[model samples]
Target chain A: MLFVFGHQNPDTDAIASALVYASYLTRTGTPALAYRIGEMNFETPFVLQAAGIEAPPRLPELAEGTAVALVDHNETGQSVSNLAQLNVTHVVDHHKLGDLQTNTPAMLRFEPVGSCGTILLRLYREANLSVEPLEAQLMLSAILSDTLHFRSPTTTEADREAVEFLASVAGIDDVASYAMQMFAAKSDLGDTPAEQILAMDYKEFTFGEGDDAQRWGLGVTETTNPGYVLGRQDELLAAMRRLKDKEGLAGVMLSVVDILEEHNETLVASEQEAAVVLGAFGVQTEASRASLGGMISRKKQLVPALEAYFEQQG
Target chain B: MLFVFGHQNPDTDAIASALVYASYLTRTGTPALAYRIGEMNFETPFVLQAAGIEAPPRLPELAEGTAVALVDHNETGQSVSNLAQLNVTHVVDHHKLGDLQTNTPAMLRFEPVGSCGTILLRLYREANLSVEPLEAQLMLSAILSDTLHFRSPTTTEADREAVEFLASVAGIDDVASYAMQMFAAKSDLGDTPAEQILAMDYKEFTFGEGDDAQRWGLGVTETTNPGYVLGRQDELLAAMRRLKDKEGLAGVMLSVVDILEEHNETLVASEQEAAVVLGAFGVQTEASRASLGGMISRKKQLVPALEAYFEQQG
Candidate 1:
C-alpha cells in the first residue's frame, strides 16, 4: 500500500488534502493510506469536525524504500524524515518547486492556485470519478482554509471556481459565515503552551548554497484574533530561541497573521533573525516585531521574498 | 510573452511538445511562442516533415528574468544557459524531478508517462479544448518516437491510449508503417560527423552532493541500423573523450539503441567510464563496449541504476 501524506506541522490543507487524495487514489484502483507526519494544528480539528471526519492516523515507522505519495507539499525539509530513502511515487502540490527528487519519473501535478484541493478537484474530474460528499466537504474546507476565503494573494480563479463547485456538492451555504466560524475555532487557542503554538504551522527552509547555505525555521499562526497571538510575544520568542538552539537553525521567526485583515506582524527571536527579516522585507523591527502590511500568504509572499534576498546576498 | 521550449539537444518529444504546449497555452488566452534551445535531432526532422509543420525557431538571446515555459525537460544542466536567471512560469515534463527552483509558485504538470506529448493531450482534454490537426499530428509523432512505437520500456498505458486517440485525430491510419518510415529516416545518417551524432540527444547530469558530487554526460543515438553506428565505435569514442575533456565531465557514455531489437550497446569513452558502467550495471566491458540487454530507456533504466549505484557508493 502506498502511504499518502503532506508536510509537517499538519494544517487543515495538509491533513485534508492527504485524506482526499488517498481516497481518490484508492477509487482509481491504487490502494493508498493517508498519514500525517506531525500533530494537527488548532484549525485542523475544527475542519475535521465540520466535515464529520476523523484525522488521519500519525505516520508509522515504515522501512526504507516504502512507496509514498506526497500531497500539498514536496520539499524534503518539510516532509518525512526518511524521505530520501523512500520511493516517492506521486506528488500533488501548490507551493514553489523545491529540492525533492525520485529515482525515476513520477506523477507530479502542481498548479499556481491557492490550494492543493483545487488541483485534486481537477484530478477527479479528469478521471471521470465523482467526488463523494465527504471528499467534497474535506476539499472545500482545505480550499477555504488555504486561500483564506479568497482573501490570500495566492487565490486564483481556479481556486474560486473549485470552492463554488465544491460548496454546492458539499451542501454548504453561507461560506463567509462558515469560514468565520472556522477561524474562530482556530483562534480559540486557550492555554496552549508557547512551544506547541510555535510548532503548529512551522516549516524549515534552506537558503543559499555551499558554505553560505543557512537553515531557518519559519512559523505562522493565522487567526481571526491576531491580538491573542501577539500578546504572548515574549513567551513565543523564548520558545523560538529554544527551538533554534535545539535544531541548530540559523534563525527563526513566527508570524502572527490576521486572517480578516490579511496582514502580518512577525516576531523575531533575536537580533540576527531581526536583521535578516529587515533586510528581506525592508521593514523596521520595533520591540522584536515587524508589521508586514498585506503580506499574509507565507508561500506566496514571505518565503519568496526571503529566498530572493538570500540569492541576492550570495 | 512566454517563451516555451525544451531541453538542449532537442529530440522529437522535446521540440514537438514545446510547439504543441505553446499552442495550448495560446489557445487558453496566454500568449506563448515556441522555441528550440538546440538543433533538432535526425528523427525530429522526419516527424516534423511528416506532419508538414515547420520546426520551432532556434531560441534567441533573451534578457535575464524573461518569462519562459519548459516542456519535456526541467533540469538546469539540460536546459537553456540562463535557466537560473530566467523566470520559469510553467513546466510540463515526464522525467524524474531535478534541481529546478523558482522564486514563486508555478504551474507544473508531470506524469510518469513515455512522453510529454501524452501529458499535453490530457491537458487539452481537461481544459475542454479541441486538439487541432497539426497539434494532434505533432503529439502523435512525439509519442511514437519517444516510445519507439510502444516497444520502449518507458511506454505506459497512457502513451498507448494517447497514440490511438491522436492517430485518429491526426488522420493517420498506418501508425506502424509511419513509425518504420521515421526510424528509417533517422537511421539514414549517411556521412554525419561522429561529434554531431554524439551531441544530438545528449544531456548532462550531476550525482551525489557537496564534496562527493560528480557530473557526467550521457548521450543516446536511437536508430534501426545499430550495425552502422557500432561500426564507427572508434570515432564515437574519440568524440566522447573530447566532449568529456572540453566540458570537464567526470565520465561519458554513448548508448546506441537498436530500435527493432530493443536493446542498448553503450560505448565507454575511457577506462573511468567503463569502470562506472561495470559497477553500476554489473556488466563487463569488452573492447570499450557493453551490451545492456533490453535496457533501451536512459531515463527509466540507465540513469536510475547509475544514480542508485552512486548513492550506494556514498
Candidate 2:
C-alpha cells in the first residue's frame, strides 16, 4: 500500500488534503492510506468532527524505499525526517516549488491556489468523479481555513469557485457562518501548552544555497480572537527559544494572526530573529513582537519576504 | 507576451513540446510564443517539415522578471543562462525533479512518462480541446523519436497508446514506415563539425549537493546506422575534451546509441570520465570507449547511475 501524507505540524489543509487525495487514489486503482506526520491542530480536529470523519492515524515508521505520496507541502525540511530514504511517487501541492529531488520521474501536480483542497477538487472533476458529502465538507473546511473566508491575499478565483461548489455538495448553506464556527473552535485554545500552540501550524524552511543556506522555523496561529494568543506572548517566545535551540535553527518566529482583522503580530525568539524580521518586512520589533499590519498569509506574504531577504543577503 | 521554450540543445521532444504547448496556451486565453533556446537537432527539422510547421524562432534576450514557461526540462543548468532572473510561470516536463525554485507557486505538471508529448495529449483531453492534425503529427513524431519507435527502454504503455492515437489522428497509416523515415533522417549526419555533433543532444547536470557538487555534460547520439558515428569516435572525443575544458565541467561523455541494435558505446573525454563510466556502469573503458550493451536511454540508463555514484562518493 502507498502511504500518503502532508507536512509535519498538520494543519486543516494538510490533514484534509491527504485524506481526500488518498481516497481518490484508492478509487483510481492505487491502494493508498492517508497518514498524519504530526499532531493535529485544534482547527483540524474541529473540521474533522464537523465533517463526521474519523481522524487519520499517525504515520507509522516504514522501511526504506517504501512508496509514498506527499500533499500540501513538498520541502524536505517540512516533510518526514526520512523523506530522502522513502520513494516519493507523487506530489500534489499548491505552494512554491521547493528543493524536492526524486530519483526517477514522478507525478507532480502543482497550481497556484489558496489551498490544496482546491487542487484536489480540480482532480476530482478531471477524473469525472463526484465528491462524496464528507469529502466535500472536508475540502470546504480546508479552503475556508486556509483562505480565512476569502480574506487572505492568497485567495484566488479558483479557490472561491471550489469553495462554492464544495459548500453546495456538503449541504452547508452559509459558508461565512460555518467559517466563523471553525475559527471560533480554532481560537478556543483553552489551557493548551505554549509549545503545542506554537506548533499548530508551523513549518521549517531553508534559504540560500550550499554553505550560505539557513534553516528557519516559522510558526503561525490563526484565530478570530488573537488577544488570547498574544496574551501568552512570553510563554510562546520562550517556547520559540527552546525550539530554535533544540532544532539548531538559525532563527524562529511565531506570527499570531488575527483572522477577522487580517493582521499579523510576530514574536521573535531572540535579537537575531528580530533582525531578520526587521530586514525582511522592514518592521521594527519592540518587546519581542513585530506588528505587521494587513499581512496575514504566511505562504503568500511572510515566507516569500523572508526568502527574498535571505537570498539578497547571500 | 509570455515566452515558452525548452532546454538548451533542443531535442525532438523539447522542440515539439514547446511548439504544441505554446499553441495550446494561446488557444486557452493565454498569448504565448514558442522559442528554441538552442539549435534544433536534425530529426526535429524533419519532423517539423513533415508536420508543415515552421521552426520556432530562437529565444531573444529576455529582461529580468519576464514571464516564461519551460517545457521538457526544468534544471537551471540546462535552461536559459539567465533563467534564475526570469519568472518561471509554468513547467510541463516528464523528467525527474531538479533544484527548481520559484518565488510564487507555478503550474508544474510532471509525470514519469516516456515523452512530454504524452502529457500534452492528456492536457488537451482534460481541457476538452481537440488536437489539430499538425499538432497530432508533431506529438506523434516526438513520441516516436524520444522512445525510439517503442524500442527504447524508456517506452511506457501510455506512450504506446499515445502513439497509436496520434498516428490515427495524424492520418499516418503506416506507423512503422514513418518511424523508419524519421530515424533515417535523424541518422543522416553528413559532415557536421565534431563540436556540433556533440551538442546535438547534450545536457548538463549537477550531482551531489553544496560543496561536493560536480557538474557534468552528457551527450547522446541515437542513430539507426551507428557505424558512421563510431567511425568518428576520435573527433567526438576531441570535441568532448574541448567542451569539458571550455565549460569547466567535471567530466564529459558522449554515448552513441545504436537504435536498431539497441546498444550504447560511450566516448569519454579523459581518464577522469573513463573512471566515472567504469564506476557508474561497471563497464571497463577500452581505448577511451565503454561498451554499454542494451543501454540506450541516457535519462533512463545513464544519468541515474552517474547521480547515484556521485551521491555515494559524497
Give the top-scoring candidate (TM-score). 1
Worst 10 residues of 1 chain B by lDDT: B96-105
RMSD of 2: 2.3
TM-score of each: 0.96, 0.94
Q: Score the docking of each candidate (DockQ).
A: 0.82, 0.85
True contacts kept of each: 0.86, 0.94
Per-model TM-score of chain B: 0.98, 0.97
Q: What lDDT, from 0 to 1, does candidate 1 have?
A: 0.91
Residue B192, candidate 2: C-alpha displacement in angstroms: 0.6
Taken over the whole model, the C-alpha lDDT of each candidate is 0.91, 0.91
lDDT measured at residue A266 in model 2 versus the true structure, 0 to 100: 90
- Please give, for residues A75-174, the per-residue lDDT of candidate 2 as tens digits: 8888999999999989999998888888789999999999999999988998899899998998899899889999999999999999999999999999
Among all windows of 10 consecutive residues in model 2 chain B, the one with the lowest summed lDDT is B95-104
**Per-residue alpha-carbon lDDT of model 2 for B165-242, expressed as tens digits?**
999999999999999998899889999998999999988888788999988999999898888998999899889998
